[model samples]
Target: MTTWRPDVLGDGYEQLELPLGTDPDGEGEISATLVRYQPPSTDLPDRAVLYVHGFTDYFFQQHLAEHFAARGYRFFALDLRKCGRSRAPGHTPHFVTDLSHYDAELDEALRVVREEVGGGVLLAAHSTGGLVLPLWLDRLRRRPGGVAAAGIVGLVLNSPWFDLQGPSYLRNVGTAAVDIVGRLRPRALIPLPKTEAYGRSLQCDGWRYDLDWKPLTGFPVRFGWLRAVRRGQAVLHRGLDIGVPSLILRSGASRFAPRYDASVDTVDAVLDVRQIARWAGCLGNRTTIVPIDGARHDVFLSTPGPLAEAFRELDLWLEWLDGADEADTSGSRTEADDSDDSDDSATVSVLHRLTGEHA
Candidate 1:
């Protein structure tokens, strides 16, 4: 049996520990943390939203949960093993040799969510979590009654790290080197230039996120982890049918700034937006890709203007999804939503004002 208790966010939130026994990466016992949002007056919806955070992140976005709750969704977020509230003493910070290891916690989390909601689930993820969930969904689609049996109805990816950003040589040559070195020293940290630009922008811009969990420069990238991410990307590039429609949100521009500047607040300082748009089609199924103008890597975290636009886009997509679900129940094909392809163009124009032709 699992138990829920008060969360660090205080009031109306609770967390549960999902023990997964010993770690396969040789880091001793390991477990994931599941946090729930239950504010008074908010009735639990039949469907729930399961949100997964990206690398170097956890479930700290309380406003995000409330937003879902307002739309009648019971919100649940996971802090994967060794991340945020799940990190135990002596355990490495977000270190995993294979992304598949996360399957255990994801399965457990879904089980709990279904047990409580008894309806369908809407998947939501940010950055790396965006990558991890689709991969897991692809695999899950082949098991037993398929993804629908697991109660997953749709997916929403926020700036998913699709292809490894940087020069082409890094994806080709550097990947091979990382794989070799990763096998030799799995925990070896990859040397990267440190910068507090993005983190500082968030802090000074009114976001009071904990720096200890999500550091200014982020946790050191390990060779083993890089190798795992590369493998995941390779698989994603081959294409995957997640067996559900997906909504992908990303920034319209990407700017790599070594230090803090004005651009850090509006553009994606992490993954390339073009890369996100380029391979987004590979996700298969009916996919809608929307670029939020002047948005950060995490569109929801962007400063006032872009952040609101991001929410607007999300609301529109969810409304469309709800309509599609109703159509499916009324003997109409859910693909009917595709008849309005013009909607995609209109949404893009809303963001393309600043830059043109991302994907």
Candidate 2:
């Protein structure tokens, strides 16, 4: 049986530990944590949302949970093994040789959410988690009943890391070098220049959370982790059909800065937004991509103006998803109808209003 206790987020939030028996990375025993928001109101919606945080991050976005809860969803977040509440003394933070190792915890988290909500789920992820979910969902699609049986209705990705950021050589020669070094010394930290621009943008802008869990300078990037991420991106580039439509949100521009500045709050200081747009179509099945103008790497963490615009776009897509479901129920829509030009044009119109660009 699973047990849940009050989470560090305090009132209305609780966490359940998901034990994975042994650590594949030999970091002793390790586990993941599943957090849920239990609102005071008795009435609940049939739908639920499962959120996964990005690299060097945890589920401390209380307002994000509240937003989903306000929409009547039973919101849940997963801190993957050795991340956030799941990290142990001996464990290297967010270290894993292969991304697929996360499957155990993700599978467990989905099961619990399905058992509690007894309805469809919307998978939400950010950055690295964004990359992880699509790969997982593609694997899930090949199962007996596929995503529908798993209760996954759609996906919402916040600035997904679709490709390795930087110049072409990094993805080519650098990847080969990383694979060799990573296999040789899996826990060796990659010597990356220290920067706190992304973290500073959040704290200096009035958002407050535990710095220890999500430090300003961020955690050291392990060679193994980077190798795993690159491998995942390579697979993603090949193409994947997650079996459900996905809504991808990204910033309009990318500005890589070594130090915090006013501009850090206005653009994606972590990743190249163009890469996100380029690889978005690789996700396959009816994908909708929206670039939130003046937004950060994490669109939800952006400033008020862009933040609201991001949410507005998200709501529009959610409404469209619901309409499609309704149409399916009324027997007026078929799988082939998912490619309707009229609906596609309407989506483009929504994008034009949000970003002032054609889809």
lDDT of 1 by residue, 68-187 (tens): 999889999999999999999989899999999999999999999999899989999999999999999999989999887888988999999988878898679899999999889999
Model 2 per-residue lDDT at 357: 34
Model 2: how large is the Cα RMSD against the reference? 4.6
Off by over 4 Å in 2: 326-359
Backbone clash pairs in model 2 (N, Cα, C under 3 Å; residues 3+ apart or in different chains), count: 0
Candidate 2 lDDT over residue span 1-359, tens digit each: 97899999999999999999899889999999999999887687889999999998999888889988877689999999999999999888899999999999999999999999899999999999999999999999899998888999889999999888778986798899999999899888889899988989998888887777788898999899999999999999998889887888878778999999899999999888778777887887767777777999989999999999888888777766776753342231112112222343344454444333345
Clashing pairs in 2: none
What's the TM for model 2? 0.92
132, model 1: CA deviation in Å?
Answer: 0.3
- lDDT of each candidate versus the true structure: 0.86, 0.86
Clashing pairs in 1: none
After superposition, the stretches of candidate 1 with alpha carbons farther than 4 Å from their true spots are 325-359
